[model samples]
Target: MALLERITGPRDLRDLTNDQLVTLAQEIRASLIANVSRTGGHLGPNLGAVELTIALHRVFDSPRDPLIFDTGHQSYVHKMLTGRQHRFDTLRKPGGLSGYPSRAESEHDWVESSHASSALSWAEGMAKGFALKGEPRTVVAIVGDGSLTGGMTWEALNNIAVEPDLRLVIVVNDNGRSYNPTIGGLATRLHGLGQQLSAIRTDRRYERALARIKRWVNRTPVVGEPAYDLMHGFKAGVKDVLAPQGMYSDLGIKYLGPIDGHDLKSLELAFEQAKQFDGGPVIVHAITQKGRGFAAAEQHEEDRFHAVGPIDQVTGEPLTTSSARTWTQAFGDELARIGATDDRVVAITAAMLHPTGLTRFAKHFPERTFDVGIAEQHAVASAAGLARAGLHPVVAIYATFLNRAFDQLLMDVALHGEGVTFVLDRAGITGPDGASHHGMWDLALLGLVPGLRLAVPRDEQRLQEALQACVRIDDGPSAIRFSKDPLPAALRPVRHEDGLDVLVEHGDPRVLVVGWGQFATMAVEVGNRLAQQGIGVRVVDPVWALPTPKALIAQAGAHDLVLTIEDGGLAGGLGSRLAQECRLAGVRADVREFGIPQRFIDHGTRAGILDDLCLTAQQLARLATETVLAGDPEPAPDQADQRG
Candidate 1:
């Protein structure tokens, strides 16, 4: 039987002997490597976590004793063990199993999280909830060392340390790279100290010599008193050097292990000991290699195959050419261009150097670029500080990730009217990474911030212009949000008689199409299709999506049927804002809103999602034609033609 077939669940896993378990882990690694190569999911993190995951399920009872994984990308093996092996083939595809943990998928998955450093806080809350109810259950939070760089983890650590009766096990999976670990003085010192301690622990004479010195000091005369004190001081210094537990020890949490995470026997033993310790909070630091079994992923320099698309199974080569330059690249290119001209320009990112497209900026102007690792709150506050210090700071961040630091943006930047420019990439729906990674909420959430100016560009040209305009606005916090979609080769400037442009005008149309951002092109296509059916429609593009375009409201008043289309959620989005404006303006035109619903959209191609939600050209054309002839006395087509 295949290794995956032999194990149906965690219970079946317990029945395997030690050798079989080892064999099973190897088989799982092989399968993970093969599948990820073909389908292209998170490869290295999952590969590194195979043995640790096996050890976790073997030692702890999940579901009953909930196991929460921080940034759940490392939960692929856990998903396989929980009877999701069959759906592994369609990983990250539309209508398939999600890439991250889903509470809707199974009872075993308690919390679905893909954000880093959040598992500890969730574990703390769940542990506290259990304590309040007087319930007995183990709560384990498996967090990686990279996640520890986040300030929220430390905040949770401080709280977890003080909670006297909170039973929580924090498993720190240390792989020694957060994208790329800083090769600073602290990192070098820690590396050397770790090696020295390993050598000292192995030598039996070292321990014996220390015991002998202590005994000898007790035997000496007047020198004994001072010598004993010196010995005690030396021991304290040695403890500080060897242990390196100052941070956690002061926080009042018990720390265990810098153990070999791949050794199943050692891991099992350590877990057994941890279970017995009736302490407030315990941390087990396990050092494992990302892409542990697969040589190709192991050899990867940075991120260790953190995220990938489809590739060849044997060589690990990508199956296709790189797609067009993304919005991230555009933002970076624009920033670099601006930086060349402006001496006061600086860039900031929350641990995302490559993702935010600031790698080139950092290379050219190393002193001006700051990568505050996985700390969005700090990124915003620091940007605010930089802005206050007479420098123009452009904080580039993902729209979804920016939600983490909304308060800082509102209070530290916007409220104070700081000249911080926020270049938000992936502002709209980002498909395939699943709900947690979607940039849907930025507009709704950020729009609520007082005195903040928000701008969404329709194309690459507008994006460049918006970036320039936002930075020039030194009065307050201004942001420009753009999609992750490939920009058009060239965007024709919207020719405006007033402030709005009529992109596609069909005279005396019963319907009017209002398009926001890049969705304008889709509206034009829909209008063309509607014209073939003897239906007339007008398509208008609003370059400015916020502040309720007055030109758009007047245009809506002229049509019998008005439809607003956007890529964001209908609730509190452009469509919602338009509807409110229409109501306030007392425009009685029959208005319809079309966009993503107020629910989490699943992983799929961007086009596939648009089609699924009936936002495609065909769907839009059909809806428009039907709405136009809804109340009219139009003759029906022949029964046979209608059926066809």
Candidate 2:
């Protein structure tokens, strides 16, 4: 039998021989490649975390002693060891195991982590709870080097410094890259070698004394200058003897090492020592490669197979390529074109330059692009600063991530009326990633922001037009939202009535259908079916989803039956807002709405979820037809060859 099958839980790892453990590690790696090849996931992060996870399980008993992951992408190995091997093949599939740590999955899993850089704060709270309850247990927080760039990590550390006697272990997996090799000062400090490396926590008086001694020694002779230079240059070894502590030590947290994370024995020993630490919260600094096992991931350093679609297990080649251009590709190509002409245009992303379609923009203007780590709040606030300085900063980020900077958007950008354009990709139900990942809340939340004009483009051309229009805005903030779905053919407006594009017009229409953003195409199918049923209908795709257009309100008032559809939250969404606005305007229309319900939608395929939610074209068309039939129908006036 395979060694991994025998070991189902953390206790089973205790009896295994060192040789057997090594064999198990190999099996686990093979299993990872096998399972992830068919169902794509966070392969690189999980591969890098094998030894460290095994060591963690060996040292600390979970369920009793909670181990929390910052960005839980690296918890795949943890899942394997904790009796989840049977369900291993179902990873990321609907009704199967989730990609991140799920509380519903097992008792070993504590936090359902997806967003970055929040483990330390969670650990601190858990630590405090253990202390209050008189429970003698260690709280371990595993954070990545990339996550350290977030302000929350430092915020937790500062607070943890106050209670230095707490039993807390923060394991910083210093693998160097976030999605694409990390940037900023923290990454440099983590990789710095020699004596200056320990200077992160060096005392001021000691530095002065060392400087004085160096000057005096150098003044003596040629030997002294050479000796000083040699000692400073050999910082890797000599500095450890002189300056042993680092940034964590200065913050009152005990420091561990620049230990090799892949070395199972070394990691086990380091974690064991951290377990016995009584001084304060300690940080175990383990250096590791992002993609330790797979050759393809190791060779491709950036992201290192960070996320993938279905691919060959051995060769690591993708199985297929999408033929249709997505909204992201359209945005990236257009943004690059915009950057070529406008020198004031700068790009900012919160550790998502590539995913948010800023890669082309960065390639075109490297100096103008700034990746401010995984700090979303900082990205918005910094954009406000750039705008105040008379420069246009285009902040491209996921719609889900924008939730992190709502306060900043309202206070810093909107209050001051900064001319910042936010380009939100994945602006609707991002399937397979689960509830927290879906960008379903942006439309609802952005409605609360005064002077904020949000444009939900219907197709590729509209996305380009919306982005250009947002750039032209001189006051407040303007944002354009687009989904990760494939870009359909450009829908040409048959006619425009007060900026509302008439996509499909029927002769003397009584029922009017308003489609918002990507839902515009779906509404066309509904209109086509309605025309066949001998129901005269007019379908219009609104350019600006928010701040209801005057013509839209007037059209709704004229029609007895009006239906609005949006690929967003039902509450305060385009449909809900439009219905509310029309009602207040004294429109005698029976307004019907279709959208995502006000609940945490679970993980599933986008098509499956839409079908289940009754958002599909066939289901919506039938519902709209029935609703229109219930209302009083308008007389067929001048049917201009309605039947093609």
Candidate 3:
């Protein structure tokens, strides 16, 4: 059997010899490439952190010590050593291993939150818990250079610096990239350190100078030991001709190394020393390459293959490439076109330039584009500032990520009546990435924001129209949301009536079906199915789902039953809002809502998840049929208005 098969757990890794450990690292990388190629996951990050992870497991006792990965995307190798290697093929699939660290998967896995820059805070709390309970365990937080861009990391760092007795070890995995090259002041200083490390490695003069200083300090009597200790603390300064290494040291945290992360010996030594240090939290800076062993990932510049689909392992080419335009692509292309004519429009994203489809806009108008380093709150506030300055700002981000900036969106934008357009991509059931990745809460969450005009476009044409319309609104905040799914064929409305698109109509319609965004297609299909079953149905799409249209409410009063279908959460969704509107308007209509239940939907294909939620056309058709039959055909003369 190969070396990988011999190791079952982190404890087993301790038994392996140095040469065997190297072989084990090689085998693990091979396994990662092979399995991830088939399953498709966070390939580059896992490959880069192979040696670092091995060293960490060997140094720290997990489940007791609690190794917390910052964003958890880089925890695949950690998963392998924790007895999950056997089931690695099921990564990111329906009923298999999660791409990130899952607490349900093992006791070794502590915090599973994939949100960036929160590992330090989790580690601090755990360290405090261990200290208070008299437990002799160290808390390990393995955070990336990418995570450092988030402000929460600094908040935790500031708190951890003051706690002198906290047993915490923070390993900084500096690969110099988070999706793209890490920007901002900290990354620049770290980049300088990388350059300094290279100079120190090549030049013998620097090493000799350090040796002479150590000797001189040792030669002196009484205060020699204390002097040497002080001098040793300032050693990083001796080589600081390139970059000052006082970022962590300035915070009063014990800083160790600009060590080679790929080197197992260096990583193990740093981790071992960090584990032993109880003098507050120790920061072990390990500089590794993002796409270390993978040539394809290393060469391909954009995001270094951060997240990949199924690909040819050798060539690093996608196994199957679709020419079909995605919702993101459509939105991006339209935004870029809009930017050409509308010079007042500026774009902002929280470190997601390519993913959110803002790349084209950034390329065309570089000055107007701002990549706000994984800080959603900063992005929203900055966009608000931009809007205040008389410029229309388009803030694009994933629907789920916007949850963090809700306060900023409410206070800075909505409160001030800023004309900021927030284009939320992946605003529906995003499959495989699991619960935290789903953009299911936006419709409900945005409903609470007063004066926030929200649009849920049905197709590519509607998406373009919505974007144009949202950008034109200069009074209050406007938002347009679209899914991660492939862009469906354009569906023209049979008639446009009072801001609602009537997609399908039946003679003497008794049932009025309302669909929002992508579900509009499914609603039409449901209507067709009902039509064949001898049920007169009229399906309509509320182009803008928020603030339930007056026409829709009037239409509902005409029909006996009103069924609303949406992809968002059932609570406070478009469906729920329409029902509430009907009640408030004194329209005597039996309103039924169909949407995703207010719960965490797990990892699966979008189709599978939708089916599981009973949001499919066939399932909905059967339910609608039952509902219509169960209800009264005619309303009382004193209640419902029969005028159509």
Candidate 4:
């Protein structure tokens, strides 16, 4: 039978022997390797979780008992077993299976989370809800060891520990990485502690010494019975001291196993034991290797093939050649240049050095680059501290992840008027990863910050100029958000002026097209198309989206119709700000907003999503022409009324 064809669901795997379970795991791995190689999704993390996932499904009744995956990148195995196998071939493609878990995708999936450390909180809430209704259902939160570094996980742990009857099981899948693991004093200490714990488990000499101490204590006079009584206490104390028990055991949650996650027999046993436990939150610490079966993934130094675009299965090489430079690479190149010229230039990231394009800066100036692991709050506050010390700290982070540090950004950085630069990658509707990963809310959230300067670049030249402009400012915090799209050909000669640039002009009754970031190219294209239809439209690029470009505002007031387009959300975004400005200026021209809706968009190709949102050139042309024509008033109805 075909590896994928052998099993219909989790029920089919229940009767399989241990040997057969192992074979099933291998088959799953083979299927994943083949499918992901073609489609290019998360590879290493899925490979590591094959047996653990199988064991999880076997022990628990999913859909009835929800299995929540943190970050959802490693849910490939879960998806396969949940009747999504046929659609697996279209994984991460436009209008196909999402890379992350979606509640809409299956009954088995509960919460669809791409942000790290949120699963525990979601599980806690669900478990609490279950308890309130007297619903008897198990809630399992599978969190990667990498996710442990996030501050919210600790917050969730603190909350979950207090609820002794919540019936929550936290499976810690420790593969020892959150992207590329950092080597610091804390890492070294954790390593030493792990080694000591391993020695106590395996070395006979240490075991014999412990045994001798136990025997000598039992052989004592009046202390014999008392000593014997304390032996169990001593063992428990030692276990608590040496292992991860100190972290959660003190909080009243049961700590079980640093088990072999790859071994199906051991994993099944652990799952069964955990299910039997009746009180509090329980953490089953499972140790597994990332990219367990694949040689190339195992050997990968960074991220263990976390996300690949398209690749050759046999040789593990990228299938397509990348001619256009990615936004990340552009940021990296610009930061590198900035660092080399300025001695005070420094960079910071919240455990996303490579993803945020700080890897090049780390290589160029290792001492200046700081990787504060999975702690966005700390990263932002630390950047404020760095700025206080007279260093220009550029904190590079994804726009979505920066949501974690909004409070810090507002209070610590913006309020204090710190000269910290924030470079946000994936600033708009990022596709395939789904709604949680989309960088849609940054503009609205950051607009609330008091003295923060905001910049949105349309192309490579503007991106470079924006970065330069941000670093040179000494007054307050500044953020520059850019998309994943390649630099457009039309924006090649576009220089970053202090304010907006008028790209096109036609006639006295002008229609101003206010463009922000990469969407400027779209505006220009729309303008040209409308021009063909005999509608005069002027295109303007505002390098600065925030501070409400005064010059641009004046120019917009001169036009008969004003259209503001951005990649971010329309609520309290560039469009909202521009409309407010127009209202304040006593301009009666029809001000229209063009951006993403308030609701979350689903997973699809970027272009497809844009088209669906009516953000394409054709859609813009139609809307603009209609608006302009509708605004044109009745010419001579007043003549008959005046005569009467």
Candidate 5:
């Protein structure tokens, strides 16, 4: 049997010899490449984490010890070792394994959050809890170097350093990239000659030998005390010269390593020593190469295949190609074009320059592009500062990640009345990446921000137009949100009514379908289908979706039944806002809201999730036809209560 197939749990790894462990690491890499290539996932991160993960399992008693992975994308190797290897083939699929670490999947996964930089906090908390309970469990936090760039990691470290009783081990898996290369002061501090010094000084054997020498010196005469003090001062001086890890040591936390992450024996030795240490919290820094064993991933410079879709495993080329432009590409091209004309235009990203489509703008205006390194709050506040300096800063980030910087957006940007344009990509129900990855909360969240204008564009033209409009608003902050879905062909409106674009109108329409963003196309389909069923239907797309446009409210007044469709949370989304506006305007049309429900929606294809929610054209048409024919609009079924 193959070594991978023979292993059912982490304990099986303990039986393997050094040569067998090397073979196991090789098998894991092959398994990762072969499986992730077919299913599509965080291949590079997992590839680099293979031996490190194996070593962790060998040293620590997981589930009891609690291994908390920062961001969880790099936990694939951990999952495989802990009996989920059988489900590797079903990764990110409907009713299958989740892309990130899932609590539902295994007890081995304690933290399921895919958001970066919070693992150290989780480890600290777990360590505290275990200490309070008098449980002799060491909490292990396996964090990436990219995650260390976030401010939260330091905050947790600051607290963890003082707690001398807590048994905690923080493993810094320094692959040197998050979504892009890790930036800012922390990454620089973790760089260079620290590796050589850590290997010599931080080794467990070296520590033991030093302790023996100190014991012998203390047993001697009065010179023994002075000699030991001199030795300590010399050691600190050497550390300052040779190790960049003085940053951690200065914070009063025990620092070890810059160990070779791929070397199983070395990783195990460091982890084992860290687990045995009684001193507060220890940081074992391991230097790893992203996409370690895979030549294809290692050589492909940009992010080292950080996250990939289905690809040719051997060539590292994408397997499927789409001729249709994505909303991201359209936005990137438009932003770059705008930057070419406007010297004042600048860009900012929370370490997601490529994914957010800011790469094109970055390439041309490299000086103006600021990658804030997994810190969204910093990005937003920094954009506000840029705007204050007379530069129009366009902050491009994923919609889901914007939740992290809400305070900055509301206070620093909106309150200051700064001309900061936030471009939210992946603004709707993103598939495969699961609940945490879905960008459903931004519409609801942004609506709550005072003086912040939000635009949800339906197509490429509207996206470009929205971007142009947002940048011109100098008095307050503005945002444009678009989905991860491919850009639909531009929907030409029959007539522009105020700010509304009427895409479909049947004679003397009784039912009006108000759509926002990508849902506009779905609304048009539903409208046409309803018209065929002998119901008069009008479909309108409000390019600027938030603030409940006056024209949309007036249009809603004329219809017998109005259906507002969005791709965000139903409670506080655009649909709810428009309905509230209609009530305040005394528009008596029965308004029904259709969007994501208050509960968390599970992972599936975007189309499949929509169908399950009865948000599809066929389902909506049937419901709308019934509501109009009956002449009394009842409440729409709660998506949370409905069967998938």
Candidate 6:
């Protein structure tokens, strides 16, 4: 039987010989390439994690042991071994498997740790629970060194340092990259340690002996305290001659590697030593290549094929290509142009230079750009300082990542009133990456923050214009959000209104249809179709969906029935704000809303998600027609005076 086909669980891996395990690693890599080629995923991460995951499964029992993975992008190999191999074809499909680790997926998958640096804290809590239950179960945390850059990792490390009884085992996957070649001191430290490991040969026996010797020397004699201290000093002196242990040991955690991550046997032995030691938390730092096996992924410079779209498996070329730009590309190109004229225009990102559309800007103004590793809070707070220094800083990031820096935006940026522009890519319904990846909360959350100017641009022209406009504002913090989908060129707007752009219109427009951002195109199409059905509709861009759209309220008062369409969360979103404005404007018309509900949406195609949310033009038209027919709105006294 084939190695992969025979293994259904971790227990099955325990009996495999070293040669057989190595073969299984190859099979896993082949499978990863084959599957990820069809449905794009974290190719480089999964490839790098093959042996580490195999070693982890062979060493510890999951679910019982509670294996937690930080930044679940590297969990594909874990999923394959835990009995989901047959469903590889349905990788990121709607009803099939999720891209990230899901609690509902399997018993082996415990925590839904999609965010970075979260596994350490989660493992801490799980260890406490196990101790309380009087259960002797192990807790393992496999965190990337990139995640160590985040403040939460340090917070968890501080707590884990004092609580010796937590009995947590930590595996620091020192891949030296997270989305991009990692930045800041943590990356430099990890990279330096990785080089030191390379200088020494990959040897488990020698490393194990050193660990045993260190533990023995650190052990107290119970009665002879003076003797033990003297012996410890002598051993420390000997180790100073022999050496390895930097920033990690200084923080009170036992430092183990600079081990070769690809060496399955070596990694297994290291993990075994860690499991046996109950002294305190141990960090098994295994140096790994991000895109280990795949040639195309390994050769790439930027992120080493960190994430990709469906591509040709052999050539590593994208299957589909567009002539126009993605929202990311558009933003990056425009920002580069902005940086040309303004010396103060600077760019910042949280180790996501390429993904956040800052790559071009960084190239154009290398000195003006800053990549702050995987720390979002630092990214925002630092931008506030940059803003105060008489510079226009544009902090570009994914909208969901913005959640991590919300407190900073409120306190540091907004409270102090800094003129920082936040460029949010993937603002709504970012499909395939699942719940945590979708940036559905930005539009609503930005509403609650005080003294923030926000803009949602529908097309490339407006997106560029909006970015420049936000940068020009010196009042406080500002943001401009755009979709990942390519903006349609065919559906250009007819004209512009007061803070609104009329995309399309027909007849008297009894039912005024307002759309925010990219949804304005759909709203125009809805209006065109509704015109065929003898119902008039007018489409407008509510340009920025913040500070209450007064223009929409004014326009709503004149129409018999008003409808609003948005691509974000329903609660406190554009639609809800429009309703509030209409009521306050004394417009007695029935204002219908269309948007995603205030719940975590699942992975699917963009069209599938929109259709489900009733955000599609056809669905929007149907829903609007039904509501208009059900309670044909009656114009109130204020509507009569407003129209006149």
By TM-score, how accurate is candidate 4? 0.88
lDDT of 6 by residue, 59-127 (tens): 998878988888888899999999999888898999889988888889998888888988999999889
Backbone Cα, N, C clashes tallied per candidate = 0, 3, 0, 1, 0, 0
- What are the runs in model 4 whose C-alpha is more than 4 Å off? 178-237, 240-244, 490-498, 630-644
Q: Which pairs of residues have clashing backbones in candidate 4?
A: 164-280
lDDT of 3 by residue, 496-564 (tens): 999889999987898999988988999999999999988999999989877778999999889977878
C-alpha root-mean-square deviation, each candidate:
5.9, 7.6, 6.2, 6.6, 3.7, 5.7
TM-score of 3: 0.90
TM-score rank order = 5, 3, 6, 2, 4, 1
Q: Using TM-score as the measure, which candidate wins?
A: 5
Each model's TM-score?
0.88, 0.89, 0.90, 0.88, 0.93, 0.89
Off by over 4 Å in 2: 178-245, 630-644
Of candidate 3, the 10-residue stretch with the lowest lDDT total is 635-644
Residues 463-566, candidate 2: write the lDDT tens digits.
88888888878699999998889897778888987889998888779789899898899888888888888889999988997677878988888886787888
Q: Report every candidate's CA lDDT.
A: 0.77, 0.82, 0.84, 0.80, 0.85, 0.80
Q: Model 1 off-target regions past 4 Å?
A: 178-237, 489-494, 585-590, 632-644
Q: Which stretches of candidate 3 lie over 4 Å from their true place?
A: 178-244, 631-644
Model 5 quality (TM-score)? 0.93
- Deviation in Å, model 6, residue 104 alpha carbon: 1.3
- lDDT per residue (tens digit) for residues 472-527 in model 5: 89988899988898888889998998999999998789899988988999999999
Against the correct fold, how does model 2 do in TM-score? 0.89
lDDT of 4 by residue, 1-644 (tens): 86557676878888888778878888889888899999888898999999889999999999888999986898999998888888889998877898988888888889887778889999999999998999988899999847888888899999998888887889888776742333222323353454345334433465478678878878899988697778867766876555655666668676656667787876776777667667566787677778889888888877778778778876678898869888888999999999999978999998789988888889989999999888999999999999999999999999988889999999999889999999999989988777877899999998898878898988788789889999987779999998877666647424434466766655554678877888888888888877887887788887788888888777777787887788988788888887788789886556677888777788788888887777777777777787677753332221111111
